[model samples]
Target: MSRRVKNPTGMRVLITGASGTIGLALGRRLVEQGAHVVGLDVAPRGDEGFEVIACDLTDDDSVTTGVPRALDLLGGLDGLVNNAGIGGPAPAEAAPGAEVRRQLEINLLGTWRVSAACVDALVASRGRVVMVSSRMAVMQLPLAAAYGASKRAMVAYADALRLELGTHVGVTCVYPSATRSPIHDSTAAAGLSLEGMSTYEPLEGVVDAVERSLLSVRARRDVPTTRKGAVEFFVARHLPRVTDRIVLRTLADRARSGAFDGAALAEGVVARHAEEVSR
Candidate 1:
């Protein structure tokens, strides 16, 4: 059943990946809705409406210290937005094992760290936790193996956490289609590309959805669909093996032509990766 989330006013939300496109927009929206927001990012702060801090999620100290500092600065946290993640868009050879490990560390482990640290506070406040996953978690994307894995891991984590926290703290995992943020470029820069990736929706829409998700009690949300994403969803579940074959064929064709744009895709993947790394 879908749960309705009320307006977030006079509430406190700690947002990680606050420097990235969606993260920044969501923070802005939270503030506009009269909620106190504390932004955590990997990059150095350059001023966003709410307080900004540098913390590395992959590191132990960052989670322990950063989470508390965020709560302290905001006085208390009523909710947490686990929006940080990384994706590598490179051919298997070019995308190193170490790099994929790092992606998992940031996307999965880091998400777990940050959310766990705030669970007690959320349980106390009856606040929600928003896990910003990707549509890739639902549909397989060619040439974005690491990205899909990380997002899938997050989906599993959110589901587990929801069952654990059932009927007390709300947990929402959002699966959004392609969004034009530095995140898209980050994927390309990281040497990874999302096959059939489409340019859809403004950054504002993602943030607005996050803001609305703040009040949501549902366990999952699949945001507005993109043409490709819609088709993938419409077809994939009923034809998993067939869809997999189609994705592989498309990738093989691109590889044969030597026309795939890994760099372009990596740019956003890296952006998504880099944002998640921020403390």
Candidate 2:
């Protein structure tokens, strides 16, 4: 029989990608709130005021071993946060390449590895699993098909997990809009930056949303970090064609402004937009 932690203060939580911008901030906040936090990252930094284990979520061996160590350190688990992910530009028209595979590996499979490993403990505690998905999961943008696909697939995984674990464990997916992070460095370096296409929200909102998902009495199915993010998620989920049109319009405008002029990865999209403008 599993017991629920009625008080937020002593809840034991494991957060992957604990060294990243959101992860660090989240870990700090949870510790401050009196929760016990254990972070897992490929590169562990002990200065984050929480115990961080060096775990590579993408590697099977690493996850299998590291998760148990974290569990041992925390004594038990109450929540698991799948927050590790990568980003790069992968155009839909182009053949799937390394970037696409890498995104799927980390964003989707990595989450799977961590979640699967934590299942037993979570079930034992009637704990919650919060997936740190992105707004891109619901709202697709041009020239970043890989990221969108991986994130969307993550949400699908979350849905399946919720159905399977709903009896004993709670599953929730948190969607955050673009925030200032190194995740976008690769895309920006490729000249396919999401600057004009998406608005940046404060990191605090995302942390708040994740906390809410973890601590809520009844877990929410889909939680967007900001009001704008909520609107985007609703529109994207309910009105697909509308979002497609909006994306196309945005792509065309960016193309006109030469945003994709020097971006080799965006050549296909830029040409398509140019053809549309010519018509």
lDDT of each: 0.73, 0.91
lDDT of 2: 0.91
RMSD (Å) per prediction: 7.8, 2.9
Instruction: Report the error of model 1 at residue 169, Å.
Output: 0.9
129 in model 1: Cα distance from truth in Å?
Answer: 1.0
How close to the true structure is residue 145 of candidate 1, measured as C-alpha lDDT?
69
Q: Cα miss at 33, model 1 (Å)?
A: 1.8
Clashes of each: 34, 0
- Give me the candidate number with maximum lDDT: 2
Clashing pairs in 2: none
Q: Which ten residues in a row have the lowest lDDT in candidate 2?
A: 1-10
Per-residue lDDT of 30 in model 1: 77
Report the number of the highest-TM-score candidate.
Answer: 2
lDDT of 2 by residue, 1-279 (tens): 113324679899999999999999999999998999999999977799999999987799999999999999999999999999899989898999889999999999999999999999999999999999999999988888999999999999999999999999989999998999999999999999998999999998899888888888887888889888888889999998999999878878898899889899888778877787789
